[model samples]
Target: MSSEAASGMDVDGGAGRGGLTTAERTTIAAAVNAVLVHCQMASNDANFKAAIRARRKLLALPTTAQCLDVAAISDAVLEVCYAMGCGGFPWATPRWWVKRRTGGTWEDLRQCDDATDDYFKEKLRMSPRVFREIQETLSPLLQRRVTFYRVPLQPDHIIAYALYRWATGETYDSGTCSFGIVRASGITMVHDVTAALLTACPDKISWPTGLQKAVVLRAFADKGFPNCHGCIDCTHIYIDKPANANGEDYCDRRRRFSVQAQVVVDMNLRVLDVFVGYPGSVHDMRMLNLSSLWVRAESGQLFTGPPVMLPFGVRTNGYLLGDNGYPQSEWIVVPYGGLAQHPTKARFDNKQKTTRGAVERAFGRLKGMWRLFLRTHKCNMDSLPQQFVAVCILHNILIDAGVPFDDNLLWEVGPDGVRRRVDLGMHQPLRPVCMESSTGDALILRDALAERMIAQ
Candidate 1:
């Protein structure tokens, strides 16, 4: 319960849920707010706590309204605001937002918390545990030191506001209806939450290191690809034409304006590395070349390891599997093409396809859980990249937590009006040309793997 409603003063004779209707609560809140007018101006700790405590009392109990000591209230509110880091005239000045409308989905928040986590999973796309963990993690950052200028929204509500918005891909106005927040506040909160999550979970989307690399190699070895680290793929994210961007540059082969995200995923479909915010018109190779991943992998910084012995007495470093759309390199291998009638080549193609599907499924699970990725977002290009990165981190976080994606959320109506599972390539542009030549040790190792597969 909120501090204002903490007193639990009900206009009702204890018949209502909290003994006070939303309106009566707001009325009491207004009286309580009066006592905070001087909280920011308070000279010392005792006076400030006393004033804040009095305000809490006003909202907590079913009480008759009385004229508050206005002078005392001003000092208290001012001191509280200053302590809150609200330094300026506008922020530190006493204000009452108690009249703001309430009672939306937030009205049932207590019930939702009290009930089973099924409600949380369905409504917010996370179990109560995951939600609480996130809330607790972000609480210290989201919480203000004081509420002298205005009552602050808790981290709990902020996270719910952002996660719900992402899960449903709903409009800003929907937050007003669902969370009873101003649409602008909802937008700010989502951005803030995204930033906080990114800060909190920076390691969620990272390259496998040290022993982790060995685990990835062994997983791929089981699939007949020795010394493999991960598979890479690119998918588009549809968005409105961002300001100051050439609209045509954002248009993909499918003619949709989008920003593309490139992902590298391990065998479990966990994101190992991610790079996003390229224009959709950019090809896969170009996107990779432009990314820090390309530089890292090329510098032997990404796949650092002692060489693994191949079946042909060959020893090589770890590499990633890619489709023909990607150019082959020592650090990455692409599927063979031409003269596919050969059983050996066909076998290699099949095996490569099997392993490469991990990245595709990674994309599927990502968009499946976060419907925001499926929608044409209005997030600015500057913020778009972080939004994608943050979502990817959350995706990996949930996977680490053993949270399951609701398959029902994965269903979407296509342009033909047929409802189906969300496509991994729903927003992907045309595939890069197969002419991207297989080159260097990547070419040699791929053939060796194929022949070894035949031998096995």
Candidate 2:
């Protein structure tokens, strides 16, 4: 029995679920009693009760207000803004109001706003607005493969509501649609979007280059790495406990709990593929093996043969770089030793270490660019990895769109020809592995890097 019920709280006495343990019952009972007390406290204030009654009457008689069309629904969404703990400031309020009240979609609202296109574009691209966008986009993409259900809020709405809660650490229902209109609009939840983001890569797509790639790709080529795809690695994102028993398995190397995701981005720093939702307990090597992505490549289901060359000059064929945690196979390469040094193995060690640098640079640039990713958030465990995928897609979009920053103009050159500005990312030490040194190890390292580059 739950501890609460064991204490004789009888929390579930009224519902009579009977299955609840004593502790569960007591906890529920306490929650019920707390709500009742709050209601009584509010009732003691006559004016507050009267105002609530008046609002209810007004809400019941809503057909007259033209603002009632979308505005009423917008107001309902705004109600969620408060529930989600987005309650601190006046302006921090959800901007969905602009689009909803103005009777326009996120894109249309962007055009009318005085804010920079990038600003509005980014806000609209966030989960709150992205859910709406996905619904519109998916209807055409899915066509008839899956049945679409219309709820008071659709799947996207549920997914958005859950994501808003996860991302903002806000109360549940922070992004929900109201009862009356939810059924009308037919909100598709985000899980469907998650599925798409994970599986949507067709045989090919064009990827663009960013500053990170400009540096690393050239560096790899200069060292003679041929057909070298970008680096591949696994990173962790924190997640709340899932209801499943296997949920705990997601805890990873940092020792703190997280879900693991593997990403393969090209030399251009565009993510070519993502293998996510692995349990943290699984080692990186095991997770990589389990992924259908690798299986397809090995079985020749993808790329029609062993090698997969991405559009941005990133190619994956017989080799992929891995850390010492993984096994060194003909298809996947790892360090010569497990972080253990030996004079005789120096050359092999240098080659593996240098070759792995490209992937590290991509990851460093990725985390540095997205401040949110620099830290972690508590997310609904099942959905966390999918959210990561969305972020990756957004990152690529930003790079390709060349989303300009206001600060870019701050770097104008002076009459003396010295530019005055700071671009932190421009000089953030090309990842540790990419750093060059004149130490005694340089010769051995240089040759090994050259050999790997030629194979690339």
Candidate 3:
């Protein structure tokens, strides 16, 4: 007999009906109590409090919900949604690819097993509910008809579970089917749904000029940040190595080498722009140089050609906030530290230095939330950065949808008893530093001309 059976303990414990002796029952109860006691003790810890706060802030929602029962089928559907948001299974296609490339031609398909197609189809069949949900979500986003195209087991749940496990560094099974569908099906369904959701940008996202100014201004002056337009930065994510032909081109610029991405966010920590899937080896300055942002702004086409009123501050060759990675110019202002400052220019330099700190806080919020950037991602290099951009886009959607944020709950007393504005972008400090004292007061006198350009 096995050790468990020989000991007279129930071997059918997994099914939760193992008849056991009084001693066995006591051991199990003690084990359960130990876990509860440990948790109760840890709950009072300062680190746990900080963790709870950080989690609440990161999820952008309260965490007062109860534990989901095993039979909560609708809750399972939400779990499926979580799976979809994570990247779907990656290995399924490759094994299929190899078999197709060498084993048989498409004309001789009947002879070939074609495991990939069957696998994906089976996954879809098992999770009809999730598949249907994904289709529903995708239909509105794609602006095209989406009929269920089933494939064999994508093993999507396995991928999702693995990713979640890696991210949280916790043990979990992608193979668990708490939902109506099988584990793999649940995962596959969620991936499709997430893709659909990211593509679902509203027809009219309110980009009110007044609102932008108000929100930004509050996040800056009230929030103790500088150069308050928004925060800008780039990050990289790792994935499965690309095919040999495209391998070198796909390699990213990190310790482990992954695909890089660029994101721009407003002071409210809402993502405004995402430029993703560039090779990792490229520097931040290089990425910026190639970005559409650089293209539009550098060419002076932003204001002259179109009536696109750029966010925050007036045009007349308006300035952009950036870190030390960018080149210094009248249009794009970098932090004035290190050798960039001369002793004679200290007064004006201090002002510029003071304002640029907002972008740093913005970066802090971005990294603090989606910690996928905190460490290496273990998946396909090409698709990882795209996934990162997708997450940021999702974050922006949540923010737009009025999810609670840290600044929303916590209020700070501003200098001079001033209330910080969070309703719109009001807190951004005034720019055009040092120029106020320039020759002929030309920049100041010309400020009127600049206003005319802005009104245009």
Candidate 4:
């Protein structure tokens, strides 16, 4: 029984109860003081024993002639004993306290006003409407993956918890409190939501092909980067040093352990493809070569159309804009490194840098909206890649929903003409391989494009 009930203090009663005579109140006050004094002088173990004896003695006190109420005196003495750390009262657990603190009202949070909605967007990285739409879209898959017979979690609550953790970069324990869930359940929800996004959203994040490729090229042409299909770059997602023997492989040039992710983004800042799970130590160029997108492009399967025609009667396949770290190819254009030697080369480099900023801006928007990528995730190394890809998918979804970019967070080029934010250490330029005819043709096309830009 609860201490209040055992002591005959009505558990539902407020601070005020039936009035006690002055003499009865004085007697109860004396008993409480004596209990406190004994507890203060005793060790924890001794005090617990004394409290038990005191409780029994107080409960057996007579309540007839002297108006000595056993119930009131017992309640007073137990309160003193618990305060002194003798530990007879039933205190609320941490989960119970959290529930009380948050009032378990997640639905109310979803229906907040504009100011509160903005705050939620800042905290959760998406507006309530977007979050709800995603939840509804992925509910079927998530329901199959995550189920509880008792205390079933709402799909929106699970997705919200995951987004909150990603947006705020908070630990699961702290993140769950806002959603009225325990830490273990929060972790499960994050995993399930991430899996659901991966399964449900890949169709929305396709590589540009056919008419899509034409549309993408037109967008690039409008930006003064004709024949460009997308911008390619790589960033590292920091992670805990793996506990396994191969941990050293994950350490990057900055001496921080991480997983590398390569992204291909369109002018709209939507991710076309993401290749994750490479070690941070791997060079960006190497990761690119290893990606499926590269394999498909190399096989002439990524973009299908008539070749793009440039000045001087030069024609070539659509190419992606990349930094010097990537080797120049018929399908990948890189800026000339000797820009200082010629005004034409300098102009070409400037245009290339400006165009390639799409990928940098995409990365900036991604890491800015979901700050989890900005810090080390305390998850198993094998599972981290899936989570990273899931964030990229979510990023594309938000862009599709017309979420405006925070222009203040856009990436800027440094004085050295490189993106200033070093998400991963700068990659050394890849050495030119013996040119296949296609690669030689790509170099020729790059020079032709530079000449074309100069003449313009």
Give the winner by lDDT: 1
Off by over 4 Å in 3: 1-187, 202-210, 213-228, 238-254, 299-317, 339-357, 401-456
Predicted structure 1, TM vs. truth: 0.78
lDDT of 4 by residue, 377-442 (tens): 666777788888889888988888898867544444667887755343334445633344336677
Candidates in order have lDDT scores of 0.74, 0.47, 0.43, 0.73
Q: Looking at candidate 3, what is the lDDT of residue 319?
A: 43
Q: What alpha-carbon RMSD in Å does predicted model 3 have with respect to the real structure?
A: 23.7
**What's model 4's overall lDDT?**
0.73
Model 1 lDDT per residue over 1-456, tens place: 643343323433254354555565567557545544543454466655654675565455333332132233333444444444442233534356543657666666547445757767766777888888888888877875444445567789888888888877888886787787887788788889989988888887888887777788889999988878898889988888777889999998787889888899999888988888889988888989999998887787876777877766667778888887776667777777665358888888888988888988788788878888887868767877897888888888788899987667768788999998775553432344554464555667877787789889
Residue-level error in angstroms, candidate 2, position 374 = 6.4
lDDT for 267 in candidate 2 is 56
Deviation (Å) of 394 in candidate 2: 3.3
- Predictions: Cα RMSD each: 10.5, 20.5, 23.7, 12.2
Candidate 4: TM-score? 0.71
RMSD over all Cα atoms, model 2: 20.5
Error of 2 at 46 (Å): 46
TM-score of each: 0.78, 0.47, 0.44, 0.71
Candidates by lDDT, descending order: 1, 4, 2, 3
Better of 1 and 3 by TM-score: 1
